[model samples]
Target chain A: MNKLCQSIRFVAPFLLAICCIACSNDKKLPFYGQREARITKAADGTEKVDTVYQTIPPFRLLNQDSIYITQDAFKNKIYVADFFFTSCSTICPTMHRNLKTIFDAYKNNPDVMFLSHTIDFKYDKPSVLKKYGQKLGVDGPKWQFVYGTKEEIYHIAEHDYLVAVQEDQSAKDGYIHQGWLVLVDKHKRMRGAYDGTKSDQVAQLQKDIAILLKEEN
Target chain B: MRKIVLFLVMSTVIVTLIYSCQDAEQLEYQTYYSNGQTLYQTYCQNCHGEKGEGLGLLTPPLTDSLFLKNNRTVLACIIKNGATTPVTVHGKTYEEKMPAFPKLADIDIAQIIVYVTNSFGNKMGMYPYADINKDLKSCATR
Candidate 1:
């Protein structure tokens, strides 16, 4: 019995070290943005406990195939979202390329989808988006390029997704949008925001998506 | 001993010759095509692919396209001033307007054209700066 205890003591440090490393690498992804609380008074004047997590508000838009997509389209789905325009000559290309990497990684995943909102809706109609998706070799419904009223698009981008977007006549493309790729879980909660143009951040986003998937499973 | 020394000298010369040839090829590509590649990646690769396989029905492929071959001069113009009109490529019509790069200089346009023409299995020869200047002048006037 004494020998067994001594052996355990010697091996315990090594096991603990391995566990520490694993735990550090596999840390859980945090839920991003604010959380709201609602209080209700019962008939006896006792307060009811209720906490409401902030979620993406419902939205309706048209996809590349002229399909009407709404918030229900991503019901119980994990998705990555971004804002871009077809005419952008600078960061949009790099952002798309990086997003393509994630898209390819998660192509076979049924629970995963991509939502790209075009800031330039006037030019990026359903047909144009369809053609654009084809050019990039994107097919199927797993990834969707959506368009809607400029006001709603910008509103969702800034308020819902928590990304910056605006119109600037002085800019080269006559508009400006962020390179942020937001990760939304099945509950429509924003889980992570990555710089769509950076490979490392995108890789982290992919890792977080895997974590989220494991969590769902 | 003398024969061994001579053999070593000859081998060194042969090796140096091979290395020099490879270096020369790399230098030529670096001088002519690298700038155009950077410009293409920045401005064109989003629609036209890295290898010029243009995006689906939106942007036309730059590789072995009869349109690019027939409209070489007009390509420079299109780059300078974005094209809104419909262009037919590979028997399909693409109507997406390619935005213009009014910021690119004549020399920059010339380099990009040379890079594009010589890349993606294209054997078109170099587009001289002088020719680019002349074409851009005419385009500006019209």
Candidate 2:
């Protein structure tokens, strides 16, 4: 009995360590959105309710290369999206820097992509976005700096991505945009929203992106 | 006697370990400097980096910069009034505009200066609130 107790004590810690490793490796992430119930008639004439996940609406925008991109471009890819302008003086630089860290981490992975939409559509043209991306040492379709109509961009930002952005004439630069870095899955569902200006949250975003990539596999 | 000797040796070892583990900076004038450090982390660390190593050519480095050393008075004004024009730091010109902190107290500016100047290979000593107040007053008038 003494020998058995000694062996059990030796194996218990190993079991606990294995359990911890397994728990830590769990890549399941919660889906964020409004769930709507839909009623459908069964084959036997019984009614059944189905919950549907809100997804990103289809979008059409121009990339930095002046290439027209649509939802089909990111059909089977995970992406990180944020809103910013070329001339933004506050928060945007930090946001870009943090996003750059993520870009560098996953630059080689074709499955991971980035979408940065310019809120100031009038000023940040395709040429301007191309120049800005060049200045930041970022190249396309891996990290696409997109430009589109202000109305469409703002609509997608506020409605689809669940972030706040608007044109505030009174504010600096004649525009206002949220600093939230939104993470979207392959299915165009928003998996997470993190503050782009914060490094810790960005780090969490990187971890979550890894989990999402593994989830697709 | 042996018990007393063992207690003395153990006490000495414990004292040395405790002293070694304690942060020397925290022991010396922590109130102003530490507050400044926290404020720097909140406001400045993002663009300026955690160690004031600045972000590329856009944001200029604050560590051991000839600009910070020469323009100590202007630094106070810049902190309160913001810099709209291009400024040269460490022989490199940075055109990015730094926003003003009109809401930060004069004492807060002083504490931030104290922390920035004392850290990241800078040894410029404590910045008193009086100097900041006088500089801000001059900036306001200008």
Candidate 3:
């Protein structure tokens, strides 16, 4: 009985130390948010977020003015991008508000660009997006609201960006999508994705952009 | 020897308390509205404005008093199916097209609704998930 008690006493200290370490690490690495992100395999089997160089595929979209835009539109600029439709009464509003802060924060910086893509191309026509942009006071050339075919939008959202964008009749709202803000480097590779509606995460996103911009290409 | 044993037990208790405290704060909101407020800012603030007044004319003000009173059904329907046509709230007309959130569950809708209804002084009482589920079924017909 004495031996068993001593053994337990010996083990208890070690267990307590481990618990303290674990509790601290939990704060350091949360289950969701900026720190939890990991580079993983994409749908096409290519590794997502290659830090070596920007190798993302080109995307063709229409600007708010109904002008055609390719990936070349973002050449040599660090940009933040997100997917949203205009009429959404849910997360899109909060995400837009959060991005607005980041946008206003870096509005004067020439290197920073903001891209908002519309998943509902059928309704979010270029003119409509332009009007929406105007309403949000988003002066394009620094910020661009994009629209494209539904298939194209969904494809980029799922395969390229690895974000959730699904269409389902059974969904309570009749469709489903994720709320994510993707950060892309000048080379068009995703450097990070933050919760678009989080002030702190967006703040971190701003910090990361500054970091990425300073890095040598 | 007593000191060492006491230190270990104290450390274990402290660690347990810390973790339990964090888990409680992160998950235990009695109302989803309080939780949804953070979720809204995390996800909807960009286009909606930080205050939920919306991003200029791009989005409509959830704080509109008369609008909220008159368009409960429209607001609920718009949340469920999204909107393309111009939805006139008060006298001002907003025609911006927004995405549908078909994946949001009844509970999520209820929380967001309650949040909107309460946050901007547009009080309509606390909408329970059960009520939202019932309203959603009626919404499906029209």
Candidate 4:
């Protein structure tokens, strides 16, 4: 009886530890935006319910390389996306500086990607973006700096990514915008949004990227 | 034995305090330097970077001691009024127009100059706030 009690005490803690680990492994990043359940009849006459997640819609814009790219370019890949202009001197420098660290950290990982959309419709042409990208040390395919019309870019920024941007005459460089480094999952759903200018938020973004990568595989 | 012990303890305290004390000049430099660090973070750090390494080729790095020395007099003016002219730093030319900071006081500019020149691999000694007015006058006349 004494031997059984001792073994049970040891085995019970071991089992509890395994349970905790398994629970944590099952933990996944939360899905942003509204979701809904869809009920369907299965082949075996049972109901199968699935949650439909809001996803990044279709987008085709000019890249820094002067080539047109579509949403299909990021197919099966997770990406970090942000909006800024070449001449913005306010938060953009700090944002890009912090994001550059993340880019360097995940440079070798092909599945991870970066996308920057320029909101300046008047001046930020493809050639300017190319030069900016080259100077920013992100002249490659993994990090695509894109440019689009004010209508398309602003519409998508407001409706799709949930970031706010506008042109203000009194603002610096004639524009003002938020600095959100949005993290999107493999399915193109936003998993996290971190303030690109804050060190703590950027660090949290680094950790959350690892979590999302694990969740993807 | 107690006398020896007290002497040892007293000497240790005195030595520590003496080594920790900053001289008058050092105290003045520290006043500028520490305040300058905060100001740099607020104004220049975004473009110049935390290490003054500057971003890619878009912004010029502040590590060029020669350029700083050659343009040391006009540095205050450049801070006050933006620079549209291209600048050659470390053998590379940066053409982007630097936005002006008209809000900074002369003393604030002096503090930033001291901090930047001292940190980021730069060893230029203290730039007295008293000398800044003359430099600003020189720049305005140019």
For all candidates in order, the CA lDDT equals 0.84, 0.85, 0.74, 0.90
Error (Å) of candidate 2 at residue A33 is 2.0
Candidate 3 lDDT, A1-217, residue by residue in tens: 9999999999999999999988866222112122233578988998875334434579888898888888788889878888887766667767887788788988888888988888876678988788778877785778898888888888888777768987666854445788888888776667788987667888888777777776734
All DockQ scores? 0.35, 0.18, 0.32, 0.73
Predicted structure with the largest DockQ when compared to the true one: 4
Tens-digit lDDT track for model 4 on A3-115? 99999998999999999999877557888877899999999999999999888998999998889999888998999999999999989988998999999999999889999
Rank all candidate structures by their DockQ, best first, as comma-separated numbers: 4, 1, 3, 2
Q: Of models 1 and 4, which has the larger DockQ?
A: 4
Q: Docking category for candidate 4?
A: medium
* Model 1's TM-score against the true structure: 0.73
TM-score ranking of the models: 4, 1, 2, 3
Q: Residue A205 of model 4: what lDDT?
A: 90
Please provide, for model 2 over A1-217, each residue's C-alpha lDDT reduced to its tens digit, 9 standing for 90 to 100. 9999999999999999999999888778887878789999999999999977889988789899898999888879999999999877667878988898999999899899999999997899999888778656685678888888978888988888888888899986788888999999998888899999888999999999999999988
Tens-digit lDDT string for candidate 2 (B22-108): 745445446768989998887677678777877666677897556678988877888877888998777777776787777888888
**Per candidate, chain B TM-score?**
0.75, 0.76, 0.70, 0.83
Instruction: Please state the CAPRI-style docking class of candidate 1.
Output: acceptable
Off by over 4 Å in 2: A1-26, A35-52, A86-90, A121-123, A126-128, A169-177, B1-31, B38-43, B88-93, B102-106, B133-142
Off by over 4 Å in 1: A1-27, A36-53, A62-68, A97-108, A121-141, A199-204, B1-30, B49-53, B65-70, B87-93, B123-125, B137-142
Question: TM-score for every candidate vs. truth?
Answer: 0.73, 0.71, 0.56, 0.85
- lDDT: the better of candidates 1 and 2: 2
